[model samples]
Target: MAAIRLLSFLDAGPLAYFTPLGAMALFGAAHFSGYVKPYAFPLLALFISDLVLSFTVFAEFRTGLLYSGWYWTYLAFALMTVAGKLMLKEVTISRLIAATITATLIHWLVSDIGACAVENKLTFAFYLNRLVTAIPYELNFLGGTAFFSAIMFGIFELAQRKYASLKPAR
Candidate 1:
């Protein structure tokens, strides 16, 4: 009991520190609340973070302060979120691995398409370069999501064991 409590506390940090991880907690919470909308939390998190990130980190990449390209990029996020919600259903190693791949691929394709559209040029080389450059970052994002998702899911499972009422029905 004491060990589970300690792990739960530790899980809180990872659960909140990153946007994706935080949404995983909300996903679990929503499951506890009742019907799992699945994509709700992840979609919300991705949309908000993409908006903020485009305006801040990659703001200079485009002309305007807020890149209109973000909307397209977010479409991919929504795709992956829906995939995660619908296909995964339960948090497991296999599902997390699959989600990581799906998220990376979706982001790559959408972002590259946005790149071509925004530049007003449809070029294969441009998309190829974008895909190559995006690989490292996408890998990192996937790794982080898997790591934190596992932590959050584990912690939640532990909590449910102790407090049965908190468990989301199968």
Candidate 2:
């Protein structure tokens, strides 16, 4: 996932918002049994990726350890992990679709709200414009989340079926 994120920096155009971080968080949440592993590993990956992007692709935007409003992105991932934990106990096509939508919406709301907060724009017009302008990016994000979720979940499920040892002990 981190590698994918790094590669994504190569093209910051229409697909700038498309990322696997959401799917990674969901994958970790669904697969890992313990609290720490799920959140810790995924968030760590995100942090590391952010660190790299801060120096390379986002050097101009870097403030401290990362860019401004970084916490909101992490918060969105954390919440998406929670959503996965709640909604993906038994991963299925429908559940995955729902989780993807939930994660996308969560990211959009949290990040956009955070952006507005950081800018100190506490007006309805500002908020509305921010959201309106973000639709395209959010759509790309939605596609990335759904595409990666299907690939990751499908591969893991197939592997577990083929290799009994890959299945978690019940």
Candidate 3:
């Protein structure tokens, strides 16, 4: 979790709008079998990172830890967990790729609602422009999720190979 949280902050900037947030949620949800705590892992990591950035890197834009977009954005984060567990239930490479794309698109759509609401009046054209402008950031975000998803699953598989105890019995 610390590693995930730190990795998120390492690339903080405009380009970082597409951090490993989706991958973190997806990996946690797919790896853990639980109802409550698994969901909290990514959500909490997001909130903590938001808090840290609010005070440090992004302090210029935000006044405090929690912001207006938090509600919508966190909702999207939680949805990624559900999407992860459902789509990546089998944990295959194909499913990971699919989930990464699905989660990223859903995230882009849902999260933009907050950005549009806060920055512009709700309108079709405004939303359309927001989506168009968001393409580059989404690409960075997509790349980050793919890279980290590979790392997360790869490391887990490697660890299981080294220690039989780490592998869950079939």
Q: In terms of lDDT, which candidate is strongest? A: 2
> Using TM-score as the measure, which candidate wins?
2
Give the alpha carbon lDDT tens digit for every residue of 18-80 in model 1.
235323533443353333444455555555554555555556664564566666765665566
Clashing pairs in 1: none
- Give me the runs in candidate 3 sitting further than 4 Å from their true place: 1-15
- lDDT: worst 10-residue window of model 1: 1-10
Clashing pairs in 3: 18-141
Cα lDDT tens digits, model 2, 29-102, are 89998878888867988899899999989898889989988998889889999999999998889998999999
Instruction: Give the TM-score ranking, best first.
Output: 2, 3, 1
Clashes of each: 0, 0, 1
* Tens-digit lDDT track of model 3 for 84-170: 989987888999999999888878898888788877678888988888988877887788788888988899989989999988769
**lDDT per prediction?**
0.57, 0.87, 0.79
Which ranges in model 1 have alpha carbons more than 4 Å from their true place?
1-37, 47-65
After superposition on all CA atoms, what RMSD does each candidate show versus the true structure?
7.9, 1.4, 2.5
Deviation in Å, model 3, residue 170 alpha carbon? 3.2
Which should have the higher lDDT, number 1 or number 2? 2
